[model samples]
Target: MPTEPYRIAYYTDEQGNKPFREWLQGLRDQIAAVRIRARLTRVKAGNFGPVRNVGEGVVELKIDHGPGYRVYYAIDAGTIILLLCGGHKRTQQRDVEIAQRFWKNHQEQRK
Candidate 1:
């Protein structure tokens, strides 16, 4: 257990749409949704179950449900986990690209 709780934030694009929340809303599998939320909660508490660094400050939360799902994020400001995007193996590259794009744009905006 972590002494300090991490804050989770969804990445918003120029139009102010939260892609992560949209992805969650689009999930059709109720069980998967429950499990995914549970995992995200654990992450916020610093559990970080099955996470791996993919590159470019992007880390992936690996979920084994179905054909394997992934949630890409970045740890910004030391304690904020910015949820970038979500997808499966087939869309891994595209998802990473989107995440990196959002991360880059965010960094630029901060400066």
Candidate 2:
């Protein structure tokens, strides 16, 4: 059977503001290399929604040199969709609420 497609996404915070774009680019490159090795294609899914849980395949990975910034991602089928990336870990509740609002607004705009 054919495999499903997987994608990637990224988010950044104030601490990562200056290098967030570059960091994201590097991430894309790394993932691209992995895809090539595994013989798969991955797409980028920028800021889809709030990152609620973090586990084995659904956890936030810290970006080197990026204090307070966590990169949340998920792997599904053959794709890795980056869900959220930002700081403000101290305000988890507020951050989630704000992210939800942003997601809602974005969805509405897509209609």
Candidate 3:
């Protein structure tokens, strides 16, 4: 079980505007089922980078939904925060690097 609650976050992109919303709604429901089965609680939010550090009680999890979609999240304090959700590929190191840099900037901003 998680020691703290979880929070969710969203990433905004042209591809995610409307379709992502609907997709996320379904994903949320799936997550709820996962939570119940896993015996944990989950929450969702937006702004991926900031919450990574802000929600100290959470842990991050990434999911590859499909060819052009990846989901990032943090689970802590008994809650799960959805950090990023968009289309890309594992082979695209650049995208990962960008996200890392963004997250790093977020860390610096806190100080």
Candidate 4:
């Protein structure tokens, strides 16, 4: 029997806006954006994307080429991938900080 694919979700801010979507829209590299979308879709379709731990319970989805893009996410309940934020190598530090905050908020809301 085939197992169900993990559900993927984006973090929404207090104002009801999905920050991931906003960040995606603001991406200057269309190719990188396309690749990111493809990776996300593949993950939702049961394929695991390339990622690494970035502390604070956040995982960095590595995107090769063109400034080295990345999507910061958190795995929850072994069934959900929560995308907290996105950024490239230059912004990794700041992005990770934001991702941690988002993940913390998400956990709090679940309680």
Candidate 5:
């Protein structure tokens, strides 16, 4: 179990939009959705999968999907697991950008 048993949360942009949650809802693959939910559940239970440091305090929770799916996140103050973005391997850069944007907004909100 994670030392902090984090609570999962969707990243909201400055405009108060939850793009990540929208993306999840748009997923048409039922099987993939179930698998994704399982993976995210593990994350909430503190079982973050093969974590890869993506820099700037962000990390990727590698979920083994089609060509590999990823959940970009950062543990805020060690208690909240901010779900930054989700995408497949091909959208790695774009997903990173999304995470960065949300992270920047999150920091601003904290101030």
Candidate 6:
């Protein structure tokens, strides 16, 4: 177990856009948004069930809710999950690509 629970933060771009939050609101159903947020809450509490690394330091979070929902994020500073973006299984390929770019830009800005 981790010594302390992780903190959840949405990765903001140079233009101050939060992809994850935008994705959440774009969902058709409010319930779906709630479900996704619940999962994020678990992540904040250090309860990530199982995650898959998807390159460029991004990890995939799977939600069995509907249409095989998925979230892309990266662990930073030992205790922060930086949410990059999200998409379902169908859009996964594209989602990963976007996340990679976002992660790279984020790292560059931090430097």
> Highest TM-score, which number?
1
Assess every candidate by TM-score: 0.93, 0.35, 0.38, 0.89, 0.89, 0.92
Off by over 4 Å in 2: 1-4, 9-51, 54-68, 71-85
Q: Quote the positional error of residue 108 for candidate 1 in Å.
A: 0.9
Better of 4 and 6 by TM-score: 6
Question: What are the runs in model 3 whose C-alpha is more than 4 Å off?
Answer: 1-4, 10-65, 73-85
Residues 1-111, candidate 4, lDDT per residue (tens digit)?
865578888888778888888998998888888999989888777676667898989989888969888898888888888888898899989999999999999899888
Tell me which of candidates 1 and 4 scores higher on lDDT. Answer: 1
Clashing pairs in 4: none
lDDT of 6 by residue, 8-107 (tens): 8889998899999899889996776888899888888878987899997999999887787889999888888999999999999999999989988888
List the RMSD of every prediction in angstroms.
1.8, 9.3, 9.1, 1.9, 2.3, 2.3
For 42-109, candidate 1 gives per-residue lDDT tens digits of 89989997788888899989888976888999999999999988988889889888888888888887
What tens digits encode model 3's per-residue C-alpha lDDT throughout 1-111?
A: 534434444433434443223444565446543532232223333223322232332233334234433433333234434343222355435444444544444445446
Error of 1 at 72 (Å): 0.4
Candidate lDDT (C-alpha), each: 0.88, 0.41, 0.38, 0.87, 0.82, 0.88
Model 6 misplaced stretches (Cα beyond 4 Å): 1-4
Select the stronger candidate by lDDT from 1 and 6.
6
Q: How well does candidate 1 score on lDDT at residue 36?
A: 83
TM-score of 2: 0.35
Candidate 5: which pairs clash?
none
- Which digits, one per residue and each the tens of the lDDT, describe model 2 over residues 20-62? 2343445534644343223212224233333346433444433
After superposition, candidate 4 runs with Cα above 4 Å error:
1-4
Candidate 3: residue 93 Cα off by (Å): 1.1
lDDT of 1: 0.88
